[model samples]
Target chain A: MKQKNDKSRAGRRTFLRTAGKAAVAAAALVGARSVGAQDKPGTRAAAGPVEGYNWNEHRWAYGIDTYRCIGCLRCVEACKAENGVSLDAHHFRTWVERYVYLEGEETARVDSQADSQNIAASGSEKEYRFDNRYKDKKVEKAFFVPKMCNHCSRPSCVQVCPTGATYKTKDGAVLIDHEHCIGCQYCVQACPYGARFFNDEERVTDKCTWCYHRITKGLMPACVEVCPTGTRIFGDLNDKESEISKFVRDNRVQVLKPEQGNAPTCFYIGLDKDVS
Target chain B: MEQLFHVAPYTGYVYPNETVFPWTVMIVVYPYLTGLVAGAFTVSSFYHVFGMEQFRPVSRLALLTALSFMIFVPYPLLMHLGHPERAFNAMITPHITSAFVAFGYFALFYVCLLVLEIWFVFRVDVVAHAQNATGLARQFYRALSLWSDDTSERARAIDRKFMFVLAVVGIPAAHGLHGYVGFVFASLKSREWWGSDMMPAVFLFSAIISGVALLIVLYITIAKIRRVPIDEACVRGLVYALWGFMMFTLLLEGVEFATLVYKGKEGIDIILEYVAHDLFYRFFVFQFGVGAILPIILITYMVFRKVRGKTFITVAFICGLLVLLQVFLMRWNVVISGQEIAKTMKGLLYYHVPVLGREGLIVSLSALFGPLVLLWIFTRVLPPWLDRPATAGPQ
Candidate 1:
């Protein structure tokens, strides 16, 4: 009877060992397959897509041709209407600055026509007489520089937000999660471009979302779409043949405050050294 | 050029968004309050840990002041928040890289340490009150005593040892509290006025100076009110320390400014321009001339000369008030002036103090004084007096 019991125990131990080994082999195979799937050109990662969006294909970039901008301010008006941005001059998601540089002058006189009424009144003149100070100076050269959220690859606003409320989308736009934002305004302080504002009515930090609502659904951002001179261009930089990528490659494009090291995606043609 | 939102008029072009300084006087008051708390606790630790016998008489008082001030530190912060209800989200889901996220932890840790140290120091007094008092007061004292009736020699010895440990621990915690506050401003690389490596040291030393000066003023005021003789040695020692720290703080600030001037950094001229225009009166006149230099000279004279009686107390008292004002101005200059210069370096902005709005002067002043009221009530309960004999437990 003792001999029979020992044989049975040895058989049970062998069976258990075999099962454990098989399970380990199975897990390793599954892990390898998932990693391999992520590396495949068209396959989504095993963790799945970002909620309500495809993270694999879309990557956005913005371009601005300072030469083409006629200082019309249509983009600014359209942005306000589309985003419900406050009409307060101090609060702007996007604005246009007319830079007037005089001959033999080290500095440029820059003025933003924050009021839509003022822009509409001035119309699309080559020489906008907004600032009287620049009127008397000998005109050297002048141009319009439209500025907005740079949608930086390394956004300081996203980095400084204490609650993870401001984040970069996989599609290359920096967005603020209003519900999660505590409105500490650390993001506002962190932004080198002066892009963000604390929206008093919404009680959240607000900035240019790159028109996320419009962009994801295959529509141009309000600023890009409403630009009459085709000064503002928005497209996918990931695609080699996209107009934005071509413009970036063909032109000597510059970013505002590149010294800040934010690696901004907003490229500009005809960017003057004194624009910052 | 018409003034908008009462912002200071500007000549050059400012980004439209840069016209309004988002941070206000309330934000200025936030750092000032935290600095006081850090400074007071540190002063108390000088007696407890370093055995600075001269500070012994006021050690408990300093601790109480710290506690009271710390209680109100969050009020200004909450008032500044757009969503005050979700303020705790900073702690709940704090981003690792963000400097402000560590504030909640640092504040909570320091407050807990201070509470424990205070309770341990006052354990005997609480137990005695529990035993001797009657009615609801007895119950209150009993609860404060944590129901620990043990006040034997062994327990007292243990409390002393624990207090020593806490004081040793508290020195860095206090420094961390105010140093972290400095970090919040200093870490912003975007703002040239605030982005200085020297900011934390400047803040910490200024806090120490303000704390010492505040205690001196309070000690003198309390002595006068109670008709008690002032401790001359204590006052002299604190004045000497205050002077030393003040000089050091000024040197740090001067070095920061000199570096900016010498480096000729891109934004330095614009910041200097803003300082020259709007901040000239506040920075040069009040902060440097009256608040700093005058106080230093007066305190030095009081310390070196054989001045005493009403004259000594009066001069010291004035010096204390001046140093306090100096520190407040420093906070204002750092927080508000930092925002005045636009990031574009093209123009300046202005901030007008609103009288009745949420971030108004009224709310700010009340927040500043609320802690003093709390301290008064706290003294009524704990009575941080050196004359009282150590309470004996039931024999």
Candidate 2:
């Protein structure tokens, strides 16, 4: 790094610049060409056709019904298998949060499959299982909140990516162009939902895309397909007859941490105050 | 191969993705290095723009210090990036909405400004060396002087005017660079610890003190090495700058912390817990007490007692070292602590500093102190000691 810097310094273009006033004024013309080539309208990494599907005609969204979740770990396994996510406790495209309130407990004892204890219980990072710590104690209430990328209308991750490598698709899913990400992980830090992780192997940031590959091809996200209880919902918001449309209309749903104003497209039913 | 990732150990519930620890110590070193550049430039400008004769002795040194540190400012950031080679993509195709989009422009403009200032300042030295020197060294100086050999009064006047303009413009360019770094952290709404409105001001004030403190330490050490009597007035000016800015930095930091607690935002519980526990020694004791308060109190005592000569220089030197450490700790507390606090607001993660490899203790320490090594090499070529009679003599 130091050698490269020195080489650049030695080869730097000299603009002779004898005029003091002109040199001072040089700073005034700082290149403010803020818009990137990809940021231009009609150039924003638009999705291509999948058979007869047109991304412009669809606004994809997802729904999570925590009440019906079984904590089976099947969705987590399917997501890893489908997306080729890093096999470790730290990286997850989608994971289930097990919120359990034992007797006399004021707060839910929340733990995810990524928890070290859970990782140890499963015997390997490739597999995941919630331990039985609360098996004997959680007699009051328990529910599993399946979490993934919200793909917000005003996604913080999209707003903070320096290279514009990750972007919000026209179809309403957030996607990353693996070819371009510099992997500064500013997006990872920007996400309030903690949905993003740096992929060390690829050296890029990755998150739950809601399985954009499958979704455009008229398929449910792998996690949703593998869900035993229909806990995860995926559909096009532009279609009134879509499952997500009814999921929104028939239920008093709320997006996670609405106070942030990212306006998440992922609607949740049976979400408790403690879910954040 | 480097360990793929070191998962942060946590107490309560934290998001699984957060366990990867998005930023390493390189991020902490990044801001700290940038702050040093800003601070050093401000000191150099005192002589070039403000024309403070007492500051003249160290002014050239300050300029060299700034340029040396400035040149390496992006090195740590590059080291942190997953694809360091594609770093220029930020400049080529910046995401307009990003707070970081303008970083390329700002840094480029400032570096050009600093380089121009250094060139104008050293033109006379370069001209003389180019005329009288031998071999590759002569060729190097000739090119550095832009192939010009003018050492006339007319050329000197133009150099002064150019240095003046560059320094004047550089004040904002310098402060803006540092202040923008602060904003980069502050603008993030996700982390409660970093998203403070006062962050930029706090960073700037601390940056000023850190720079002034660095000047004091370097000026004294260089003087000692050259076997010259340290310029008493120059040291006094630096001490005063250090004293005044240190107070402001301390107050701004204190107020910022107080406001964070008073507002008692959603994640206050964990913040308070972290502060009382892990942060007690690092933040309250080391950063606040021994590093800042002790130096401040000693400086105050020296000022009132009308301290002078070796006693004063020794005290000020100690204070300078302490203030530098204080500012470094502030950067650590802000950058690392911000990440250590879980975004879920329910837990704290322990960022384990790796012993060796890319994101490790050895690399981090190198990033922190490596600029001084560069500064030493810079002094040999440019010889930024024009104030002393012996060193300032004709080449």
Candidate 3:
């Protein structure tokens, strides 16, 4: 009975291996046929979806509705918590900017109070004073702009790194391979958006990862999850039904520093001309 | 740590991460030191390749100066790095598009060229010392001579030819050495102050000025210390060269500033405001006023007036010292002041020189003096004096 059982188990293992091979071969053939079909004359390739792994299938995008941001600082706190970022004000993966446009002023006075602990206290309702100089101006209009990594199509940091430690993923996120980074800070200087920083403890360049870990696991980024107003939108551009795609299509959006030609994926609604 | 970040007195909307200047005084020292090496090597080439006979007296000393400074050029950069041990990764796995990737290769190539040139220039003397000395000293000299004790006229001829060829090759290598440093700063498109096509030329000319000035000061001081008669002709030539180079550097700077002010670009207002409010003293008073103008006027007077005797030497010496200060301040302004203006174009960032920290003034001074000490030791090993007999014992 023992000999018969051993023979039966071996036979089952062989059958399973053969089935797996056949499935993989059939999948490869299908993939090849689809690719060949894409190349056929007079046929347009699909706009968004690329045939490959799940990562390659997705193209992530972020949208900010500047009108809706309340400058609550919750998203900033959530990002710091999720990433284990240092508590120092100088180190941040994301921050909020408050723009005050006084009546009859051509240039709006802009200040980003990313350091303040009491971000909940100051907003459109109550006039706040900062640096002893920014006393409640003759108020006209006010709004908040939250800034993070634009995650450019052609990232300057990746181009400037002496080692290929900083790279762009297939899912359109710029990431740093921390283990390989030499910490020369060239990337820090190269980034026009001021997105990159040298984490003293980690001994490597740090930047916004688009919350890569959670997104890859089919979860929303911590910042987006914690946002109260749905001001921060994160979704796959490849999926037409995703909120980010709909928002981007419905609203006229703009990226910061378009003159830089970085081709940033992060789009903002109601973007002010004063924003850098 | 918060105190360090808070210390930067800012005026408007600076990116939070930009409040603390990333590159510090150590970075400033790196370029200053390299400029010295490039300048000194160029001065040596004046004699070796250009056949400027007046520079002959100080040719070997200038080469030695270049080598001494070149050896320590990488230390400041290494210390500034977050991971000093992995610095070689830049060389082993260089990303081609990065301007900084050329650093390791340029440094290695320039050093090797200097070594070969120095060896060929000092071969005859080393051979003579090897023949007369005894014990380990003899063995060391013999090894330095590659165990070849041939001091024949034919051998001397070959050595001179090789030295000439190496010196010729070293001219562009020296230019590349400092020009590449300038390129490192200039290639950063993000920083408006540093991003200019004129940077490489400006750095190269300033390097020549600093080199000529330093050699003048060293030659005069060494002569005074040794009680040897000052080489008046050589001093005059160097002073004149210093004047010419300084004028050229100033012209380049003038063009760059004039264009920026005239063009009226988007960020021009903020940058100009930064220069006016924050850098008024350092940029205008020290670098342009006392450091540059004073030396240029004094050196010019000495040059055209055919000034001689104690007066000429004293004025020339003062001008040399001033030119060194000028170049140093220029590096400070270029490296530090460039960082002072935030990339946001909304405000200015201030940097306070730390007293005793890693990127502080003390560390910078140590990096500067370390090369001088090395040069002192190197001179003890192989005397740079052309007048000394080849068989004379080491000092």
Q: Please tell me which predicted candidate would have the highest DockQ against the true structure.
A: 2
Cα distance off (Å), candidate 3, residue B178: 1.2
lDDT of 1 by residue, B1-395 (tens): 31223344455667776765678888999999999998898789888899899987788889999999999999998988889999999999898889889999999999999999999888887888888899999999999998998988999899999999999999999988898888889888898888899999999999999899899998889878868788887887788888899999889988987887788789777877877878888988898889999988888787678787788778888999999999999999999888878888877777778787677889999898999999999888887877446532332
Model 3 / residue B334 / CA error / Å: 0.9
- lDDT at residue A38 of model 2 (Cα atoms): 22
The lDDT per prediction is 0.80, 0.84, 0.79
Better of 1 and 3 by DockQ: 1
Lowest lDDT 10-residue stretch of candidate 3 chain A? A40-49
Per-model TM-score of chain B: 0.95, 0.97, 0.96
| Fraction of native A-B contacts kept, per candidate | 0.74, 0.83, 0.58
List TM-score per model, in order: 0.88, 0.92, 0.88
After superposing candidate 3 on the true structure, give the runs of residues whose Cα lies further than 4 Å from its correct spot: A1-54, A114-136, B1-7, B390-395
Clashes per prediction?
0, 0, 0
* Model 1 stretches with alpha carbons more than 4 Å out: A1-52, A114-137, B1-9, B390-395
Interface RMSD of each: 2.1, 0.7, 1.9
Between 1 and 2, whose TM-score is larger? 2
**What is the Cα-based lDDT of residue A30 in candidate 1?**
39
Candidate 1's interface RMSD, please? 2.1
lDDT, model 3, position A217: 69
